[model samples]
Target chain A: MSTDLSVPVFTNQSEEELGGKWGMVIDQDLCTGCQACVAACSMENNIPFVGETDAAYGRSIQWIRIERFWQGSFPEVKMTPYQPMMCQQCHNAPCEPVCPVFASVHSASEDINLQVYNRCVGTRYCANNCPYQVRVFNWRDYADARVRPELVTLQNQLNPDVTVRRRGVMEKCTFCIQRIRHTEDVAKSEGREIRDGEVVPACAQACPADAIIFGRIDDPNSRVSQAGLASRGYHQLEELNLLPRVTYLKGESNNGSNG
Target chain B: MIKKFFDALNQPLGRVGLLIAALVVLSGAVWGIAQAQKPPEQPIQFPHKLHVGLGIQCLYCHPGALRGPSPGLPTESKCWGCHQQLQRFADPTTPWPTELQKLRDYVQQGKPIQWIPVAQVPDFVHFVHRPHIAAGLNCETCHGDVSKMTVYENPQVINMGWCLNCHRAKTEDNSQNNPTNDPAVSAMLAEKRTKLTDCSTCHY
Candidate 1:
């Protein structure tokens, strides 16, 4: 309520320890980039179908997507690395600032960026500020009963844990916060901490190659923290020192020439 | 005259006046009716005071509350479970109470008692009962002193602001590890504070 407009950067250790830092380690060597994670993320998160023309206009809303890059252009084709890119969940998330309505803020407890759909005034400042470009803006009334009648019938299929965002609100991957809270509540009721691999995000669970590893990085024994220490472990835009929680191991070798 | 009417709207004070008038009408008619001004009509005059006075636990009838999202209205069969015993214990000369007889008739006809929900958050809100109960919040915290009420009255204005206020209060108490709460529970309670304010925590 105070006039103080400071946005928390999710650095305070005590807060983070209580809620814990949620980090992901993607083993590029194990990832085949089958796009299963992408598909699963879309379904679980209720990502929109912008259609061909809208997508061509660069309006596709994919929280987690398979980004493919062809390395070489010759007869001796080089390795094509398939990376699963989503919200980096940076500890020093740049997108937290520049929100006029304070919609985009750091979850001090969880150490992840959260965008409150109801609070968002749709200035798209968060989207512009995001270095990862993962934030999606709803330009029109798409998810409502007015535009998509089939969605009205399929409304029951929508995850009860996630709210179907209305128009003019910005939204993105929350690391399936609903799932995290659910597990956290359940674990607390049972009087125990959430076990590793017990609470998996939609994308991580659907990964056939087991490339995506999500766990509490605070725990030294957790898969994410352990895999993050791998020799090839690196982060996107590492020079910027955004301190992205997603650690990616370098993928090398094995090119199946489909040509 | 028509031009003067439009000119009046152009002035800031005039606009403010119109807004005030609109708000008064809106608050008087819509907001007044929607909230606590008038208690909702119930299908049955089930008195909480009588049951609570007789030493019946709130959890006994609201068993689902301890386990799940909803504290459902007691089913007719559940009522019958106790009422049958109560009838057997009553003196043979004394006739059954009218309400009890009505309940018996309903059970015999296989009709359920349609007790209107006293506390209801919107469909979008996933207000599960167990977590609050687990966090040591009794039914009275939100529902008020239901044990004293004949008809369930929503004493607290159940709104987002009301929810946030309580959450902030708890957060302040737990954030620094208050001596009152259990050390382990204090940490969990503090952690829960962050989630409580999160829009997705309830809205989702």
Candidate 2:
């Protein structure tokens, strides 16, 4: 391993050429900004609601958030299409190299970025280094029923598949890895490859307009790959060479409603 | 007061006393950990030896293990169905054991018996028993033989290292282990090894 930080040590040009195993394509045009994906993500991943005060402090632990910007000014102002942002699951993730412990890592099998919660020591370096700013840290024991009495009843609704993270742990979107693992296991048991559309993340499943599409991007025949081939599809931070797996389709303002 | 305490520690006797205090604290911590490792007491003293001796299979009671992550505890009705037909319970002349009496009370009250799970992994570890079973692992492979024991207890501490040890053993490509050296078998083993050792496999 090279000590010189200027040169990337773990960069795999082959992986970049081959493309990622799992990929997502989000159609910004179809997104209604209803926050359905946000709600579903929280429920599915056992994400704690950090109350109004903490949320005001920008400490809300939402894995995915809808980001929209205003264009022009005053009467001519128009809202840009809702861009639901989450962990990009970059092939060469900037977050992976910064962790003091190997908490933020790349999964060899899945070919995706992983945050091993048990290995995390609350350094927050990964969160700071993340270009997408998707990583969220648990500043308080927000999930504990004793700390937040209101969560006592809500605790029952927690998905047992996902671990309820405690204070001082950094977490981000896992691409609903639990669902991926479950579908893979089922497919393996039946002696067949995982079919396209079999594994659906919480956000993709809850989308009313079916804006989110997740599948094997390596497979050219897969829906996600077909969607990624569109001229409008582009990576969030393509200049940095992060090789993010997520492809966002540009929303045209010429839909006539904006005028 | 702090100065006086440090001055006292300069004496040989004070040093001996400090060493004794340190030893006492260390032993107390060790004892606490030992107690934590002990199997928790269940509501009913369910005898595994008696049940296994009577030729009852583990799957009969915990059927969920075959299909899903949790091997669910049998319902009280399942217990009563057998106990009600037993010669010991049918005859009024025969006296019921204290444990059997407790079971009877629970069934009568329509209360679920609280069975404390002995073998458990942390919340971070997502252990699915279905794959292990599908891989042709007997119940006794991870869970020790139940026929010899009374109350259910883990054969050993269920930790990440222990899980990895078995995973490594099965996946190792050695000529002695793989006599045939079949390419297909080796390929399958290699794939299994990668999946098994991957952190995301157990931890999400």
Candidate 3:
């Protein structure tokens, strides 16, 4: 709510310690790009579908998706699905600085960058500023009962903590803050500290191969922090100095390719 | 203020206007109260008292309440688990014998009963019942008392402001933390203001 109308980019050591920098370590070597995480995230977060044609035009509202990179072509093709791309929770975020309405902002207690839907006027400046191409816009209200009758019964299954967005707004992953809050609440009620790895995002939980590890990055002892600091760990566009919370493990290679 | 007062009296029907205004306001209040109490008629009148009182917990009928986003309503087969033989009764005084009829139709045709949703949240919230349940939050924390009511009603006006208030209050007390904060931990907390305003926490 500043007069400058610019989204504030913040990082607090205290909040980083409490909530911690919730980073994800995705091991691409273990990923098959089967799109299970994509489907699970959609169901868990109530992400509306954009249908086949819009999806073809790159307008699909997938919070997490397989980014395919082809090294060769035809029968000689070497196609690899690199990783699931999402908001990096950047330390020096280009998207945060560019948002005129400050709809995209980060908090000290939250390592996950937040998008204030009520404040968003759909300028899409944040989307344009983002290098990861993870933010999705709701071109239409496709998740509602009128557009998808089959989802009518299942629609109520949507996580109540996360809002089901209407058309014309933008949305992306928030590391399932609702679940985090719930875990925090339970921990407090029991008069115990919230242990690391107690809370996991839906995709991390649903990953068949367990390729995703979500935890505190501030705690050097935490698993996510250890994996994030690994030699093979690298951020997408790390050269830009976004310092994204999401880290990727290099895909493994075998004799099948060279031999 | 004087000009406006004289303008009303100038019409010579000021008393009549006041009476009409009073009548409208009185009727409006009555209508508002009635609307608040009225429950929408659903496709099926699900007997909560019978099911819940028969030692069937909410989780029994709502099997997915623990793990999934939604709480699944009971299926016809679930009802037939007990009602198959009960349907053969010839007693004329049964309160709702048609309940069995609806079950029979559903089982024979695989038609889903259109039960009305009593509780609803706004579009922007990311609430989950499992976490709340797991957190030891009682059913009545936000749901009010449901066991006493015959028909479900909108007991809580769940809005953004409502949720935000609770979240705000939660930040004040650090009772959820370890009972004994280590010297190093206290020092770290004192050094920085926690960021509670992150968008990714709620949006995603």
Candidate 4:
């Protein structure tokens, strides 16, 4: 009998996840960095707009961002691909312990880091503690009369399932806990367990390249586990051992640029 | 004394503590008086006692309970459906009731009934009536006994804690088992139990 030792298994939240852990696997080679995931995540999560001035002052509220690394010096400069950076949802999350209000705790069921906006007291400790720099602080009350009327009109299109966070709060990627909850509710209503590919966060759903894959890593047959088992699978800042649920697959370099 | 009182009120740190205490007392008094007063004035007099006494199920008028997120107000046509034939009175020549006549005027004008909601949840809350209805709860669970009310008023205050109590308590009770043999409903009952305590269950 043949055996595969490379399968990454994780378990969390559902009754079916007896030993399950939720994780994600991203293929960098296939991603064009069009930023569909970034746009979709903001819309789905109801992330407030900080406007041009605040954005210029390094206060943009983008939950998922594309970090561009420019490789090489002057004459032979090249764009070393776009790395989509969001909350890692780490197993040994640095932000979890730092929270004074217990807002940034590891969700025992889903195996993901969660930030409850109601519980957050805006200490900025979680933001400082996060090695990936994915957490963002709500500097201003962006949803109310503080913003331009036109922008407030834009805010009307916010997702009803996610909170429009008030000022003095810290927020980050929750792996779309609302979506996770809704799907689980629907599934449990029907007398079945959550399927392998059933739960996909907004970022994974929006990517046109099909680069971002999110699923239960505990299931050996899941796409995320399969991708993690592949040769190119690697963790960012592995030495820090944050144990992030997000795993990146090395993209194939184009035209002999940096790998 | 007035000058000293003014000075005390003007002090920022001390003023806040006093102001909050005064506001709390003032608001609580205002709220108590308001609740003590008569019920809200509606465009039309919709007496739940008369309607419910006629053997009308709550779902007949507020059909959104099982189907949608809210127990929505009945449409104008639903009221008109009964009132159009209510032309004949005990005297056989008496015109419709004054309130019924106003209802007829609106229906004939092609205007919708803008019924004022009695139980209004805050904007931050996304309360849905479906799960509560599915849990085999009657209209009286959150909405006190409406059949006994002549004038509709909020009998119970609906806050996060009020909802949390039911959501947390129902799992242990499990008294509201769905009669349907459908597999999905059973799954929902199983899955929805733990999710009741989740924040996004109502807030999101």
Candidate 5:
């Protein structure tokens, strides 16, 4: 038997990590659509609110929205709720190729489809390219006098790291990039690897059902990757071939159980 | 001849008038740029030097800084924690700062301070100071040097790319830089090839 004295060390760096495949696995069985995640995400990322008029017209600037659809009618009616919709962070993102500016681009480091707000000139080419209708346009200044009166007061309380967007621009989800960065920074500073339950977003942290699972796609043992592999897990609008990073599990039938 | 007559007709006076108009436009542009760059001032003169430099943690007055969306404004009772005694020595007649006096007046009359916030993050972004603190980031990372400042000053420009860059750098898997050694990344990675690119992570 040949004895090897030197121990091999695995570094976080790898060539395969350059092109990211970021995706999410949401357990429909666990989802209640309580809107806590929606509120939490909005507060964390600084999403502007549309008053009664805009909300009535479906013009709200929600980076992630809960999409509810009715499958059947009357006697067999089923109203299923799908939540946390934003850019899918697609692999062959249609939004990416069309942008006049490089505002919408896929990140090489991770599978994240990034929307660089400062680079955006509000041409809204990315919005037209998206198949999921995840992109939102800001029609009016959220700071207008009629909107949330407490909004200005609320602004000062924001996480100083994130930007507060102005009106007349297109903005969407960056997957809590601030939190992800903060967690990664913490992990890096300690000279250790990023572990589970440490990089939770506001919505995931606030989620009562633990419906949302977040992690690196490369780790085979990660909860998100396993959930992605589940039999019921599937992507939204899969036929479009946008290759969304977010995955959803089929809603469990509550039938036969005591209602 | 005729060409010279037309050239003189549109001559030095016309050029001088155009130059004067251009100067007016340029000055107006300068004023507009200056106005846009100016940060709005807050209502009260709340000094961090008087509070934090004397060994006050952020949580002491703004108790909700850890639990919820905001580091809420302190109540009159919270001010009384120190001022009940300190007031007699500093200014027995005026009591603590006028803001605290106003808070006491509100409490007596059953009202709350109509405080105007100094740091304004737009409505779309969600930021939790608690998680950062829990993750071991100092309160000073985003807040700037609070301990050294006499009064709060708007010193940072938190644009979108700024946030994305920080997030990108932090998430870059640098073993030399990680501070808290949070386990969620590996747990997220272990179950599968985990990628942090869900829209729900930041926007909803």
Candidate 6:
């Protein structure tokens, strides 16, 4: 029997060739490693506070984390610029393939990797497969008020736009798909295209230094596209050929000699 | 004990008892599912038929449907706004209906009516009503004909399959649907189909 070529299949094509819809640019030079983005992301996404014990064990469900490296050694030691790490929204995400349930699937329309909570069977295969190590699994019912009595009062602040994920589901940065969808809906209702800087993710919005930029990367006029074109701009782990949507601008090292 | 249990299954009378027990469990499961599907009892048992028949638009009660995800329930004042002005409630000699009395009590007590939503999708499904309404869908399309019923009920099970069915139908390319056969229109429809079918569109 002849193969039906009309049927759609997943391809490992690079996002640069396909042109991603949503993209982010984080300026490492401007980031202060304050962790505001992490806090904002948790509140906006309804990510539970896994407590000190779980967090110490590396069970904290932070969608965005700041990575700080040390520059030089001993006497001349200095802190390197802070780099914010998150799900790169890769066009050919490594996590997408390993999910047997297809819970970690790519959205063709949005061009972003999605973690379908209801579909996830807690296999944690996607988390292990991810090169970025951005995916966090719900080790317990952290958001459930019945399990966590203190969360009952905090539940009032939960964002209704984003789903409160339960135990066993592996989740990661969605690039604020809810905000993107809301902006798209509003733009559609007004019979216009989404304007530049119209859809900002929680991390980008909460950045005090204005280090993070988010917008349609396909549009050359967008802020994210312009930032991505900077000479210092580079993707984390670019050698992997994941085609990460996040572009990080290199920051100048502050060695002791500079002081 | 295990061998004795197996031995009892060998007898005809024991087999009949086992069959009866299995049937009871199967019927109980079926009944449980049916009970879950039944419409939940609302606090007011608000008469949709009378209000809809009176020519009041659905948007008047649920203005949020046109603007956001939730179609907010009308406040007690909104209900009292019309009820207090009504000729039936105006006359001291006439008594208010039980449902209207509940509304008056709520308004007087300064408490909000805790309305139980009928057509609700799970938390994972981020359903927004504005887009559906903007797509030229009438109130009765998904919510059924409120004009005919007293209490609101779902027209169909609000599941992924039901949603996908409508999305597929709307996005499908048909000669009858698109008589002009314009390339630009077809391209737009194709793009829309992708957006509508994409998992992230509904489930964030």
Every model: iRMSD? 2.6, 0.7, 4.2, 3.2, 8.1, 0.6
Model 2, residue pairs in steric clash: none
Taking the tens digit of each residue's C-alpha lDDT, what string does model 1 give over B45-130? 77899999899989999988888778888988998898788755377687877778788788999998888786877645678889
What lDDT would each prediction earn against the true structure? 0.79, 0.89, 0.72, 0.78, 0.67, 0.89
lDDT of 2 at B102: 88
Estimate candidate 4's alpha-carbon lDDT, on a 0 to 1 scale: 0.78
lDDT of 2 by residue, B146-194 (tens): 9988888999888999999999888877785577998888888888788
Tens digits of lDDT, candidate 5, B1-204 = 989866755789867777888999999999999886675554445678768878988888877767645788776566656765663646656546576665557667866555566565565455555555665767677778887775566567766556556555555544534345557764534322223333323432
Best by TM-score: 6
As a whole number from 0 to 100, the lDDT of residue B171 in candidate 6 is 78
User: Ten residues in a row with the worst lDDT in model 4 chain A?
Assistant: A11-20
lDDT of 5 at A75: 86
Name the DockQ score for candidate 1. Answer: 0.34
What's the DockQ for every one of the candidates?
0.34, 0.77, 0.34, 0.26, 0.10, 0.88
Candidate 6 chain B worst ten-residue window by lDDT: B171-180
Candidate 4 stretches greater than 4 Å from native: A1-21, A252-259, B1-41, B85-93, B172-194
Question: Candidate 5: lDDT over CA atoms?
Answer: 0.67
The CAPRI classification for model 5 reads as incorrect
What are the C-alpha RMSDs, in order, of all predicted structures? Answer: 6.0, 3.1, 8.4, 8.1, 10.5, 2.9
* Prediction 1 global C-alpha lDDT: 0.79
lDDT of 6 by residue, B1-204 (tens): 999998998799889999999999999999999999999999899989999999999999999999999999988989888887888678878877888889989999999999899888899999999999998999899988889998888988889999999998897777854668988878888999999999999998
For model 3, the superposed segments whose C-alpha errors exceed 4 Å read A1-20, A72-77, A251-259, B1-121, B126-204
Give the winner by lDDT: 4 or 5. 4
lDDT score, candidate 4, position B154: 74
Q: Which ten residues in a row have the lowest lDDT in candidate 6 chain A?
A: A250-259
Q: What's chain A's TM-score in each predicted model?
A: 0.88, 0.92, 0.85, 0.88, 0.84, 0.92
> Which residue pairs in candidate 6 have backbone atoms (N, alpha carbon, C) closer than 3 angstroms, thus clashing?
none
Largest DockQ belongs to which candidate? 6
Q: Which docking band does candidate 6 fall into?
A: high
By summed lDDT, the worst window of 10 consecutive residues in model 5 chain B runs over B191-200
